[model samples]
Target: MKLRQKILLLAVAPLAVAMLGIALAVRFQATQLAQHERALVEAAYLQSKETELRHYVELAQSAIAPLVRSGRTDAATRQAAMEALARLDYGPDGYFFLYDLHGRNLMHPRQPELVGQDLWTLRDPQGALTIQQLIAAAKGGGGAVRYLWRKPSSQQLAPKLGYVVAVPEWGWMVGTGIYLDDVESTLRQLDARAETDIRQTMAWIGVIAGISILLVAASGLALNVSEHREADAKLRQLAQRVVQSQEEERARLSRELHDGISQLLVSVKLVLETATNRLRLAPAEGAAVAPVLGMALNRLDTVFNEVRRVARNLRPALLDDLGLYAALQHLAREMQGGSGLEIAVTQSGTPRELPDEQATALFRIAQEALTNVERHAGARRVVVALAFDADATRLTVRDDGHGFDVARMQEDPQRGIGLRNLRERIAALCGQFDIVSGMGGTQLVASLPLARPAAIAHDPVSAGPSPS
Candidate 1:
């Protein structure tokens, strides 16, 4: 390998390692962060479940409250209350259960066989005597406990969180429980989603690292590739801004035509009418009508001048009538009026009549390029070049003024407005767009293929004379 190639490898290898390290670091941080978030998600689920269980149990209490308070201790009254609670069911696997002070089930809503069963000695998988603990908690004013119970929906053992309360006058406990498996499943789903997002982030980091490793020799371009995503986002926004600007310009032009040129033409018309009336109806003759004729002629001249100015602003006549070559010449002459800048035009190969879209795009690009140069390029001279060949057309505008950073301008909305539009225009034609700039000078280059035109005229922004 050449010395340059070897040195390039040495520099690239470490950068590649560093990038891998960063990817791993980011993955680790994401995982740790996601784990903490998972706990919060689980906590939120648990808290909500607790609240719902309390509400459901309260509903059961409300149903049984009237019966227990009726000032009657008859066995029939107790059976009525038990039967009423048993019929109460809200959702799937949701119901009320009752247990006597002695540990026999009173009203097992879904499992009637458990009514007479002795469950005080029955233990869950965790070896906790489930009924005994619940009875103790209920007797001690009422609270909640966790254990394994058969799910009413699936008849499978599942973790449950139950709340129980005592009926002091009736020697019974009433309670309800919510299945905890739902909370677990929800937490698991969140954890799975978090893992998927982390994998995706790691994938993106790997892609960026792989790219950096491959292009270490062109680090600036690599950095620019990362920056290109940001630029693409801005480009989408610029597209809308460019459209709004064109519409605003069109509205301004329309106003000027109506209020400025239209009024002038009306004045000119009135002047000619008066002149014609004087020659026909008045006694004045010869030199007497000469002054009126001269005044009419001056008004006509003013109207003609106004029309040309508006026409040029709408779409340069030279550009439409004479083609790009003559239009560019006119453009240079216009910019050199008061500006301290010398603009030059050069062409190579033969100039042909391009389609309206192609000719217009080239002219507008040059017009905008010159406008930017005159406004920002504090240079003494600028060169506008047009080149045509068998396969493509190219236009370049270079300025000797203190050239600004092309990359910086592209990233900044205020600075890179026209250059961006020039690029989009050329690129629409399946062409290449490039800008090379430094402290000494800046050059904007665009090339369009001769293949059947692909670029449509999207911008109507007349670059002839921008409004102040």
Candidate 2:
């Protein structure tokens, strides 16, 4: 992957994971909390129903209190009590019921047909003995029991909570009950609302995660665009520098030919013309013409030597003939003779052959460093060291001169061209280049890996000279 894509992934992946984990945790906790709330609500509703049922049973007992307290157990008193209870209902589905100790129905206001039936073995859909459970609650000194029963209003079986009390004097079970469909309906609504809220929460988390990832990706894209712009600008600057350098080199060569070799050729031509005139005028003056011709031959020799010097400056033939070592040695000798600087060239490890492109790049780097030292460093002594290792080659140039600011010089486009060229050449070979300058001296080092070829076939700045 490209670096931009990797950066975006690194920034967004973790955030997405964390958001997903948070959503899951919220869903789990919300579900658990909803269940707990539902239990609390159901319990509270059932407790209220139990209390209402107990109150209805008390009211029924009050209606029959006069007969029971008057010590009457006759059939008429029993009939009167049953009639009173039959009339003592609160709502259409609310009523009091009576059962004998043997589970025979005594009085049932809602279902009159059940009043005379023996219902001890009767079971609801859930297999619970409904009448027996009610009688048991009465026999246990008045409490509540839950079971299924037909609701009078709906005429369908629904859950019921019945409260009952025992009347020992008459062998009767007095009870009242409230159907629980309303409580369940309320809880169902609550559960639906809770589910909707959880879904919304999860959706919001997803939206936030998506937005965060998009923001990070946008930032990475912006960074990549900025870097690309900077690279393009530097490339344009490098192209301009290459053109300017070529023009400057051509100008120098033109000046050398015009000022040195051209003058010598003109002097030689004048001497030859004088010798030719003398030979044409007097054949006996041939000895004088020979002396003039000899002078012309001497000037011609100077012109040839100057031409050789210019050609050597353009590209050293010694490099192709004997390799980098001999070329560097010759360069040091020539520079020392001209600049009067103590220049030394040394090598370490066994010599190794290199690709032409790599060798040429290194040679150019060395040449640029020495030129900088001679022209700007004002150094008395210079050392150039070349080392060959198992897998790499290193070149170091040091000069004992008053140093200049490395950063400042590199920042100056006009003054830093030579240093920049040296660095570019090393970079084209995929090598490491380092330069350190201070009041003490300046040291420039370039190290290239032997196993790797040049990243490019040629460097633009150093395209002139290469080993054959």
Candidate 3:
């Protein structure tokens, strides 16, 4: 994996996990909230049903009280009472029953067959007394019981809220109940909604995970490509440097052979000429040999001057003996002689000596710049300026030439080497380099930190010759 992929994964993995965790938490919270809301609704429904049932029982009790108190509680009166109770429809799935204080059923709305049956003898499959408990409570005081009730015939379980009231004058108890199965239907619907929400949240999590992985992969690929390009550029720069070093070495050797060996040969020729002239006047045939020696001498002088010029061109001794300014002046003068181009050099502020590496780097940059100007620029005027300000040494070279496009040159790898090298050299010195070129002219500017040389005893002679 590339570094970008690693970094992106490092950044995104935690977030993805956190998002999933949050999604799960949110889903759980939503489910809880939905359940809570459903519970509240069910509670409300049950409360409303309880109120309606209580009102219905009160109405029945008030209607039957006058007949029972007047001692008209015969079979016809009881039948009228049952008819009156049946007319008040409490709701569907509701039941009404009347029982005596002895726990015997007096009347039941749906099951008249058990009218005289003792309810205290009734037992559910769980072996629990059913009607006897409610009769005892009603005989003591009116109360209600909310419990699971089962139908004797079908034995189906259903939730019930039962209310029992005592009628001591009639020796009877009254009770009513309603089934709770309808409320459970609403809960089932709520559960279905919660399940659907969970599924949707999981789908969103999957989508987020997929997008995060794709982004990480793309970022990694991009980083790998960028690193490869940088490595290639560094390799090309190294190769260029190798080629330049080889050429420089060759130039140095050529200069050394011509300046050292050629000069010695010319001196030997001069000595030979003096000997030939003296022998001609002596008793020897030196006159004929003297002309040949003269011709040799003339040839030797030409060769010596050529050799000295070539050596100086390769690496000027004045650069080492004198300083950077003097060397530049000499270079400008020599270039002016050969190219017939107008060149000027200017300096200002204190002229302090620089380290050997710094001086050499600056000189080489200037040399390359001038050479490029000669080959590419078709102008007659050039200016090289050096100045010192505060702790910085600045150099500027400007040429009034038909300058090429700077942007294009920078993009062209083939033509950009010189500028790149110059930038690298300045960067190595913790300096800055900038170039500005257009159709009108071009300018190269560099600024280096003015590092003071080590303190040494000043010698007047050591200062060397000044610029002419």
Candidate 4:
């Protein structure tokens, strides 16, 4: 993958995983909590139903209390108590029932057809003896039994909670029950609502995650674009600088030829013309013409020297013939004589032949730094140090001059052209260039790596004062 795509993936993958993990954790916690809530709610609802059923059973017993307390075991008293219970009810499906010890239905206000019938063997759809369980609950000093029975209102067999009590005086069982379908319906609604809320929460999380990922992607894209634009600008600026440097060099050469060599050639040409005229006029007096020819020969020599100087400036022959050290030494000597400043060349480590490009780049970097020192840095002494190692070649130029602000100069195109050229030269060779300047002085170091080197012992070298 491309570097940008990889970076985007790195930025987004972890976030997506974390968001999904958060969603899963939330769902897990919410599901567990919902289940717990359902259990608590169902328990609370059942407890309330039990309480209401108990109250209803107690009210029925209270109504029949007169007969039992008066010691009346007659059929008419029992019939009157049953009729009173049959009339006492809270709703359409709420009523009392009666059964004797033998499980014979005595009174059932809701199911009148079941009255006076033996229903001991009767079972609900789940194969539970409904009457037997109710009778057993009554025998156990009034308790509740869960069984299936037909709901009086719907005529559908459903789960019911029956609270029963025994009237020992008449050897009869009496009970009432509340069907559980409505409780289930209410809990189902709660479950559905909870599910909806959970789904909504998940959706929100998904949306937020999507937005966050998109934002990260957008930010990365913006950053890449900004960096790309900056790189392009820098590239264009470097190209311009290269062209400018070439033009400046060409202009300098043109001036040298016009003002130095061209003038000398003109003098030589004039002296030759004068000498030719004298020789033509007095062919027999050749000794007199020798002086004119000598003058012309001297001018011709000066013009040749000027040509050599310009050619040396173009490409120093020492760089290809002798190596970087010799070229640097020659440059130092030339700069010292021209600038009338103290310049020194120092060498350390094992000096070895370098690649042509690396040698040229290092030389140019030193040349520019020295030029800068000569023109801008008003210093008395300058040190140019070259070091070699198994891994790389290093060049250092230091001048004890009042230094200018490095950042300020680098930002100013006119002031920074030389520095930028030096930097580009090193960069083209896949090297590093650094400059440090302060009131102490300016130091420029350029490091270029050799492609490969033979195994050789490295020397511990340091830069110090130049030899007087």
Candidate 5:
């Protein structure tokens, strides 16, 4: 993948995973929260229903209290209370029921025929012995029981919440009940509302996560664009500089040939013409012409040597003929000859052949460093070292000249291009290059790995005071 795509992937992959995790966590939490809230609301609703049923039952108790308040000590009072309860009624589906101590129906206000019938083993829809449980509650000092029964108005089996009381003055059980389907309906409605709220909350979270992801992706794309533009600008500038340098080199070569080699060739031609004319005019003058021929030969030899020097500067023929080591030694010798500088060469480890591109890169780097030492370093002594190892090769060039600030030069392209080019060539070969410089001297070191044909190896060079 391209760098931009890789960067975007790195940025987005984590965010996507985080969003998914958050979404799942929120959904689970919301469901739990809704369920908890529903339970609380249901309790509150059922409590209110219980309060209403109790109030209604108390009203029924008030109606029968005067007849059976224990102060009335007559069988006639008991008969009057029983008849009154059987006849008394309230709103539709609201009534009191009575059972004797023997688990048999005494009076059912709504269903008159059920009076006096045995009801002990009667079961609700869920297989609970409804009449037996209710009789137990009434006999054991009165309580409530939940069961299913046929609601009077609806004539349908529905859940009922009932309260009961035992009258000790007579063998009677008194109870009142209310249908509970309304409470269940209210609970279902609440559950639906909670689900809707949770879903809405989830949707909003999804939208917010989407927006955040979009923002991050946009920022990454913008950064990638900015970096690409900067790289393109640098490449354009380097291309222009390279074109200009090539033109200047061509011009210099042209001038050298025209001024030196061209002039000598013209001189040789004129001398040959004169010798030819003299030889034809007089055979006796042949010995005198030998001097002219010899002079012409010397001039041609000088021109040939000058051409060779220029060619060597362009591309050393020895580099192709004898490999990188010989070429570097020869360079040091030539530099020392011209500048009167003492140059040292050190060799280490086994000599191994390298691929052509690697050999060329090392030679060029050495050539540039030596040129810098000759033109810019003003040094009295220089050292060149080449090491070959089982895994890699290393080259270092050092000079004992007063050094310049390496940082300042790096920021100035015009001043640093030669070094930049050298560094770039090393990088292309996957090799590392470093330069350390100070008042004492400057050092250039480069290393290359043998295993990876396209990679560079780095060997750190220890720098110390220049040789005395």
Candidate 6:
């Protein structure tokens, strides 16, 4: 994978996990909240049921109070009590019952056959006998019982809330009950909705995770492509340097052959001519040929000196011997001699010695700038300055010449090559180069950081003469 993709994945993976965690937490909290809401609703319904039961119980107690106080066992009063009980209709999943002091059922909304049937033989869902317990409580004062109830014909079960009260005059127990299945049904629906919400949240999280992953991958690919292009550019620059180096080497060799061997041949010719004239003139005639031979010898000496000078200019031995400053001074003097132009060379700040590569680079920049001045500038004076401070070494070459527009020259491939090569040389050393040229003159400035000996030792080739 590309670096961008890797970075994107690194960035997104944590976010995905975080989002998923948040979604789970939210779902859990939502489920809890829904459960709480359902509980509240069920409680409200139960409270309403309790209210209804309380009303019925109060009315039934009031109706039976007068009859029980009259101490009447007459059939008319007993019929009126039964009619009053019938008037209180039982709600769905609800029933009302009355029990005598002996725990025999006097009236029941459901299972009316059990009325007046038995004494204290009923057991609740947990097998706890409840009728005798309620009768004992009734005898003491008034009380209630709440437990699960099951009809004999049905398998369905439900929680039941019941309240019981005693009629002391009649020695009877009255109560009402309500099943809790409807409340439970409401809770189940809430649970279902919670599950649905959790699933939806998880789905959204998955989608975000997928998109984040894709974006990371794309960024990685883009970074990889950018790295490739940078590598290619560096390779091209290296190739150009190799070609330029080869050309410089060839020029140096040509200068050496022409200056050294050719000078020797010319000297030999002068000596031969002197010998020939001496043989022809003998003792007396030799004096006449002496002037011609002297002139020839002088010409040969001139040719030899010119050849050596050209060779030195091609590849200066002084560069390695005396260092960059002296080499530049020598070049400036030579340019002044040949071009008849005033060239000024100046040094400022501290004169600390530089590594060979740095010195060579500065010298070459000076050489190329002067060469441009000699070729293109129709000016009379040129100034070359070299300054060194603690941080960096700076070189500037300026000429008062007939300068061309920099933009127009850069647009042409042939004219632009020299400036481009100068830039590349500076860049390789992690330096900066700038050119400013106008109608009157052109100036080239280059600045390079001073490298320590350790850095120079690592790459002697880069520390060599500037490629231009």
Which candidate has the top score in TM-score? Answer: 5
lDDT of every model, 2 decimals = 0.81, 0.85, 0.75, 0.86, 0.82, 0.74
Compose the digit string of candidate 5's lDDT tens values, residues 59-130.
667777887776784768866777777666667877888887677987787887787789888887788999
User: Candidate 2, residues 1-468: lDDT per residue as tens digits?
Assistant: 987788778888888888889999999999999999999989988898888888889888888888888888999999999999888888898888889989999998888889789999999987889888888888889999999999989999988899999888899998888888877788999999999999999899889888888887888889889978866766677888889889989899999999999999999999999988998899898888888988999999999999989987888877666677777888899999998999998878777666677677777887888888999899999999888878788889999999999899887655676777778788877889999999989999999987544443332322222322
TM-scores, one per candidate: 0.45, 0.73, 0.56, 0.74, 0.78, 0.57
> In candidate 6, how many Å is residue 63 off?
9.2
Q: Could you give candidate 3's per-residue lDDT for residues 86-189 as a string of tens digits?
A: 56555445667888888788777666688878777776556666788778768777766666676444558866777778888777788787776666776788
Report the poorest 10 consecutive residues by lDDT, candidate 3. Answer: 455-464
Candidates ranked by lDDT: 4, 2, 5, 1, 3, 6
Cα displacement (angstroms), candidate 4, residue 90, comes to: 3.5
- Alpha carbon lDDT at 42, candidate 1: 73
Best by lDDT: 4
Q: Please identify model 2 stretches exceeding 4 Å from their true place.
A: 1-32, 43-108, 111-150, 156-177, 199-207, 210-214, 221-225, 271-305, 378-381, 399-427, 436-441, 452-468
The runs of at least 3 residues in candidate 3 whose Cα sits more than 4 Å from the true structure, single-residue gaps closed, are 1-213, 219-223, 226-234, 237-241, 244-322, 348-353, 449-468
lDDT value, candidate 2, whole model: 0.85
| RMSD in angstroms between candidate 1 and the native structure over all alpha carbons | 24.7
Better of 1 and 6 by lDDT: 1
Give a tens-digit lDDT track for model 4, residues 1-468: 999889999999999999999999999988888889999999998888888888899999999999889998988998899999999987888888999988999999989999999999998887889889888889988888888888888999888888999999999998898889998898899888888889999999999999999999999999999989977877778788779878988999889989999899889889889888888898899999899889988888888888888888888877776677878889999999999989989888876656667777888888878988998899999999898877788999999999989899887755676787788778877889999999989999999887443522232221122234
| Model 1 misplacement above 4 A | 1-236, 251-263, 266-281, 338-340, 453-468
Rank order by TM-score, top first? Answer: 5, 4, 2, 6, 3, 1
Q: Estimate the lDDT of model 1.
A: 0.81
Candidate 6 lDDT, 1-468, residue by residue in tens: 966666667777887788778777877887788778777877787788778767777877787778877889777887677667756765554556788877888887667687778758788768867788767755666544556766423546666766677876666788776666656787788778877877787788778777866776667677778877866765576567669868987877676667765666667686777768687768667667767677766767777686777768666767676656668788999989999989988877766657767777888889889988888788889999887767898999999987888888766544466777788889989999999998879989999997875754333232223312
List the RMSD of every prediction in angstroms.
24.7, 5.7, 9.0, 5.6, 5.7, 8.2
